[model samples]
Target: MTADEVFDDIVDDLAGRGVSAGKMFGARAIMLDGKAICCLKRAEFGVKLGAGSAAHEKALALPEAVLFDPAGKGRPFKDWVALPASQSEHWPTLAQAAVQAAH
Candidate 1:
């Protein structure tokens, strides 16, 4: 799905779970009791997320997690880890990680 779709689905999903949802970086950010959990980011190069510093370290431990494409032009938004398009099932995993990072 597209970034906007990602944002919309995520927001609806999280909110359905009683999480707070809002906009960030022209995409969507999710929060649990006001603490961030994840976001769907729209970039010129591709759809991605900038899961903060703490999330970066934790996500590294997951088998499915990966740093965004090395050559990707998202250097300006450091600490971002890109999930491949094929890893659709991992969105929840990634969203959780993003929330972990923000918290």
Candidate 2:
């Protein structure tokens, strides 16, 4: 699926569980309990799955995943996972984990 398709799927799936979609930093973001769990920024997908958690470590283990730092070459956000297109298939699952981790 394309980026738009992926974003739609995530938004739809999350909505079923009471999460909503909104704009964050000019990108599409999944909002749960008023918090933004995941977002699509410039073709990259980002998830706030909590730093040091198993899910966070698992995401970082993927070659397509990295630390989310909007500004280049800086200390990355500790609780965010930046995912590349290569890991598209895992988006849904990771997005879910991010939501669960948020609580």
Top candidate on TM-score is 2
- Write one digit per residue (lDDT tens) for candidate 2, span 3-88: 87998998888887878988777888899888888888888888898999999999999987899875556878899999887788
**Model 1 Cα RMSD, Å?**
5.5
Q: Which ten residues in a row have the lowest lDDT in candidate 1?
A: 42-51
**CA displacement after TM-score superposition, residue 94 of candidate 2 (Å):** 0.5
* Residue 27 accuracy (lDDT) in model 1: 46
lDDT of 1 by residue, 38-81 (tens): 55554311223444555466554455555644444645335655
What TM-score, to 2 decimals, does candidate 2 have?
Answer: 0.92
Question: What RMSD, rounded to one decimal, does every model reach?
Answer: 5.5, 1.3
Name model 2 segments beyond 4 Å from true: none
